[model samples]
Target: MHQQGAQAYQQTANVVASSRERESALLMKAAAGLQKIKDEWPDSYDDLKPALTFNRKLWTIFAASVTREDSPLPHDVRENVANLCIFIMNQTREVLLEPRPEKLEVLVRLNRQIASGLRGM
Candidate 1:
């Protein structure tokens, strides 16, 4: 029984690891696309554009908060749930624009895996 439990854990971890890579790639592309929109029309896109434009810092904070799915956040955290997926994609784009592509890629993967995992239920 113990070995079975351990195997299950290992398998779950492996699944998560692989999923992370897939998620990251999707996020990077989404984020970049959103950023391009914002850059092309700063006046047109609202501050909420996920492509890393006006509210990158704020978006990052929100993303990090959601990433901590188990944490207790401020009352306002729930307010941002309307476009969570879009935001994730935008965040991916934002992170990919950085000089350190490897690190950003990792983040994108993690976000993607999380998003994918939740879609089932």
Candidate 2:
């Protein structure tokens, strides 16, 4: 029975082999958008709300996916991801309240790092 279960898991894993890559790409895309806003500074200020909105929505989806009972990730990993999402939510709130360009650094860094990890880096 155990062997059969292990085999099933392996089969499913292969079926979703590109999920990690897709996740990584999405993260990178979000990071790049945020970075552009950061790099352009006051001139790009008009884009802040939209960029942040995109990132927040992306992270929210990730949070929901990780918390699902059907998620294949280990429990500890899911918990860690949830905690990170919480931090992201808090940081995003701070950015919205203060509206500082420098305040976006952490969000940009976290997104890139998470994306790298997803790529097995």
Candidate 3:
């Protein structure tokens, strides 16, 4: 038998599946918007920033919701997409000030690092 999280993912598959028809597109859209922010924005925060973290259900829902085409691309293509999402978000918070700034290679690197660091903890 699957664990609660896996079982939940299965049960909610229809929620995502049914909503995907309408919100999947929206999630795609939202994901694109986040990508745009991530891509074009800069890290002005310099000192302190928000970090990305995931709660299990939310991660399950987020992972379950999108198809392959979304921006940030739902890393479930590999594993633990929610953790990746949190990592990126936290890294983004680290490098970026987020009133709005342009994207940088540093932001991507920082995001990656933060995600990687998170897995260790």
Candidate 4:
């Protein structure tokens, strides 16, 4: 019984780690997309809409997960995540309205930082 329990725990841990890694990779990809838009702005303005929309969708999913009553995260962490999601939504709206290259920097930085944090965890 003890051995089986240990094995199950290890399996769960591995699954969680894999999920985190995937999430980090996705975040990095999104950030890279934003960076590409910034590098090729004006010509890339059309691309900005899709990239920003993708990120908004991703953050919305995360916000939903973290805010769930059954979420495993601590209350404070969940609250913080919810708040960050709100900020992301607002920022995304601003970027969508203006579609400026400089505005993308904030989204890029946020994605990279969040990805880094996810990777560390």
TM per model? Answer: 0.32, 0.86, 0.31, 0.96
Question: Which runs of model 1 end up more than 4 angstroms from their true locations?
Answer: 34-121
Candidates 1 and 2 compared by lDDT, better number? 2
Q: Is candidate 2 or candidate 4 better by TM-score?
A: 4
CA-lDDT, candidates in order: 0.50, 0.92, 0.44, 0.91
* Full candidate order by TM-score, most accurate first: 4, 2, 1, 3
Model 2 error, position 71 (Å): 1.8
Error of 1 at 100 (Å): 27
Q: Which model scores highest in lDDT?
A: 2
CA displacement after TM-score superposition, residue 41 of candidate 4 (Å): 0.6
3-42 in candidate 1: lDDT tens per residue?
A: 9999999999778666555544554554455444545554
Cα lDDT of model 3 overall?
0.44
TM-score result, candidate 4: 0.96
Name the lDDT of candidate 2. Answer: 0.92
Candidate 2 local Cα displacement, residue 67, angstroms: 1.0
Question: Best TM-score goes to which candidate?
Answer: 4
Candidate 3 vs candidate 4: the TM-score winner is 4
After TM-score superposition, what is the CA distance of residue 90 in candidate 2 from its true location, in Å?
Answer: 0.6
